[model samples]
Target: METVTTRTVEYPADGLTMVGHLALPAGTGRRPAVLIGPEGTGLNDFQRRRADALAELGYVALAFDLHGGRWFTDPQEMLERCLPLIADPERLRGIGHAALEVLRAQPRTDPGRIAAIGYGTGGAVVLELGRAAADLKAIGTVNALTTGRPGEAANIRCPVWAGVGSEDPIMSAAQRDAFTAELQDAGVDWRLTVYGGARHAFHHPPVDQSVVPGVAHHPRHARRAWHDVLALLAECLPVAAG
Candidate 1:
């Protein structure tokens, strides 16, 4: 197995000191980089492990924070903060841009070859970044099917892949339709996968704390979504083989 190094990186985002988990693959040569955005609950071990896994695959990965080092165990509290943030495109773009800058600054990262993969609110942030015309090779989101402002998706310069549970009330069929319609109308290269019978946050593991309604873990679909993300990255921002 390749040796992966991990560290905590603190950066400013949304007026908070966002502490992100940065993972670097072995060797000194620059590699394709990926930004991992955490769910609305905030950055935690799950996302850190994902960054390490990506590093093991030879891509520099940074699991960026949303709650500035705090994890919300209360679903209502999480919604109180995240709902407004997700609704504001500019705020989401600011957070994504800050994390992207942090990732690009790393010596191991090939700035020109970078992708963003986000979960839930994090997914929404990366989508907003794409809408804002940030230079990204690919954008992948799970459980977040947010539509951008009028015609702003035309600014997206790369392919986008989205995964969501069919039973997810938050990202319902109608919402998915609107999101896809926006992307299609903008002529962006995009794809959406609906996992049958899964609920919102199916990609997330079960938490000890109380979770929002309609959120559940589907291990099978979670694994499938991860594989889909890997495939998308392989196709769009492949790291050079050693």
Candidate 2:
């Protein structure tokens, strides 16, 4: 069977019934899977498509919802709800670990071999997993990461990748430079790929946001980011024989 199935998974955490979509490859035998963190907007279509794509590749994929299905395009309100999680770095780590746990419950999933991929704000959450020391094989982050917190990149024992655009407004050269320096100082086995001229959320194939005159687009970088993700995932989550 080529089809993957999904359901609203309710987990007990943080005083809410956190809902998520779990996608598993049909007729699989212990496939390696991952916990895919959604972009700034909760469990949006982009993430669901990505999870489905992973299933087509014969891997189980679960896209976790940190926002509990609530979202806003207004930058201010978005900041309001999302700010606190990042504010307390320790709490963010807990949330990351919690999402990983849900990924482990898939029947066809190989708990021993799983990774994480986070986008935008979700990228920061995945980064915190390193601080909390989640037992993950690998981790990938796509743009919008912070480096100010203490022990942000310390003792990360997994193969990690940080992908961002050179022209991204949020992750400026100076900020990303500092983030990379911390990663190196912590002795992490990681790869930092910077796309020449892509904006903050360039990975999404179709975005209808009003361009703010300054940020530019680079489809080449967007494509390369996807390739890099697959390459990293292959390196992180190995396939097994039936």
Candidate 3:
């Protein structure tokens, strides 16, 4: 395996100190960057490993934080925190913008060419960031077919690709329809893919304990979603030669 550099960073967000993992590809020059968001439980090893994997593919990646660097193994705790955050778009935007600033400030990142991808609640945060009119090359989200404030999606300037499990109760048919409708109304380029026979949190690996009902891992679908996100990034945020 090619060596990649990794670091832990602390930043402020939503009146809390957030900690994230930053990964840089093994190279000598600046590269395209990606900001990663985690599920409702907050940033964990899974997201950090994703940043490391993206770095290996030549992109500077930062796995942004949520919940002030805490990971909730309890479903109730996760829900208590995430539900309110999701309902408040401004709070989500604050967290997303804080992470974006951290990613852009990295010496190895090509600030002008950056993308955002997130899972679950984190996915919603990226959408909120897009709605806030943040400049980004692309936005890819999984299991987060969330609708933002009315007419706010028009602020999104980049192509968006979202994925969800067909059986995901959290991202139901109505939610998907609303999400697509918002994008269409906003004139934003977007795509949605539903993985059959999967459930909510299908992109995640098996956990030691279940954090949410109806959330189960599907290895095949997880792999497919990762490839799809990578394809979205390649299409919209290709790394330039240094």
Candidate 4:
């Protein structure tokens, strides 16, 4: 097994030096990598654990901080924090590219086989990358692909897999149908897995959702969602564009 190494990196974005962690799998060969987009709140325990899990699978994983600061003052404050960036897909795409560049530049990472996975806003970030960042191989998005990207939609050349809870309040039924339709029009190979009886943020087990509405957690779906992330990465990044 490769020894895991974690280090802090300063990413220039959004008007500040955003902090991120680089989890590298031991040994020097070029390894597949994934840039993890943080949830609406920011980088949290769940994101870090996911990074560690990816490293254990022999991939260089970067858990990036899209939101300002290390932590949030409150969840409602999330509106003020992420609304601007989220509303504008272009900024989100720039953040994704910056993070991708950071990860791809790492000595241990395989730049040619890079992919991205993000939760909440982060999920949207990765999905947009799949559409806008032609260089990205695969995209894993969970419960965060809300808005539509018009021109960017038709350009995503890589495989896309989205995870959504059947009961997720954030994702409307119409939105799902439209998303699928867009993928078809673009000729992008994509899959949508809707977890029955699950809610939003299903992958974050220990999250405290006191402030969040209709966003509950289901362990079964979370487990399956995490497992599928690995399988998707393996399939897409391995044959991804170099």
Q: Which stretches of candidate 4 lie over 4 Å from their true place?
A: 238-242
lDDT of 1 at 66: 94
Question: Per-residue CA lDDT of candidate 1, range 1-242, in tens?
Answer: 55899999999999999999999998889999999999999999999999999999999999999988999888888999899998899999999999999999999988888999999999999999999999999999999999988989999999999999999999999999999999999999999999999999999899953446788899999999999999999999878642
lDDT of 3: 0.93
lDDT digits (tens) for residues 1-242 of candidate 4: 55888887888876767788889887778788989998888887668878888887788999988864466647778768788887888888887887888999999888778888889899887877777754777888898755566766777768888889888877877878888888878787989999898887877765568778778878888889988888898777652332
Ranking 1 against 4 by lDDT, winner:
1
- Candidate 2: what lDDT? 0.76
All candidates' lDDT scores?
0.94, 0.76, 0.93, 0.81
Q: Which ten residues in a row have the lowest lDDT in candidate 2?
A: 208-217
Number of the predicted model whose TM-score against the real structure is largest? 1
> Model 2, 3-67: lDDT tens per residue?
78777777755555667778878884888887888776567777888888888787888888877
lDDT tens digits, residue span 1-242, model 3? 55899999999999899999999999778999999999998998989999999998899999999999899988888899999999999999999999999999999888989999999999999999999999999999999989988889999999999999999988998999999999999999999999998999999998854646788999999999999999998889877543
Candidate with top lDDT is: 1
Clashing pairs in 3: none
Q: Give the TM-score of candidate 3.
A: 0.97
Least accurate stretch of 10 residues (summed lDDT) in model 1?
208-217
User: Which sections of candidate 2 miss by over 4 Å?
Assistant: 206-208, 211-218
Better of 1 and 4 by TM-score: 1
